[model samples]
Target: MLDFHTLAEFSRANCVSICAFLVPANLLATVLTIILTALHRPLHQIWQAAGFASIFALIMVMHVYSWFAIGVVMLPTYILLWLAITCLLANLIAILWRRRFVNTPSLSNNA
Candidate 1:
């Protein structure tokens, strides 16, 4: 099958370039998410931020997986991944909560 070791080596070699974009993107997305949450903004806005963060997180995880493939275990990677997952879950729960409990009028009263 797939030669993960080779892939790991390749990723490791390019870690700097990969992280350059991911780090800033993740930071901006997370910051926006936090701001939206603090402001009590609409669920859709929060979702947008969380969605972007989650996407970046997934990409970062691939880089972390490369380290694992190469037999390099880093605690920071686990922490970062956990944070990413938590943020995504929080956003999802907010959306679900709004959809489930917040009632919207199905029809207008006036003709």
Candidate 2:
């Protein structure tokens, strides 16, 4: 039978491993999302921007929490995540603003 301490250690190790896996996956997904947005302008609409921003923010929070919980001190990693989230939010706001205010001229005006 596994002792309490051994069980605790296993749980901690599992959490750390999961965090390690998630960090890279989240990063890759973020990068891919950015690339896809850039390559396809239509896909970079306001709603999509907001959705991506939220997803990026969620990933950053998860990474940070995981790092802290796992007792890792990757300062540069934390900074990068913060920067990515900030940029995402800014872009999302700009997109929402444009979508809300940029009205197109209606064809009825030509009559």
Top lDDT hit? 1
Query: Residue by residue across 1-111, what tens digits does model 1's lDDT show?
Result: 899777777778998887777777777776777777666677778777778777887778788777776577778667656765665666566556545544654356445
Off by over 4 Å in 2: 1-44, 103-111
lDDT for position 40 in model 2: 42
Query: lDDT per model, in order?
Result: 0.71, 0.57
TM-score of each: 0.62, 0.43
TM match of model 2 to true structure: 0.43
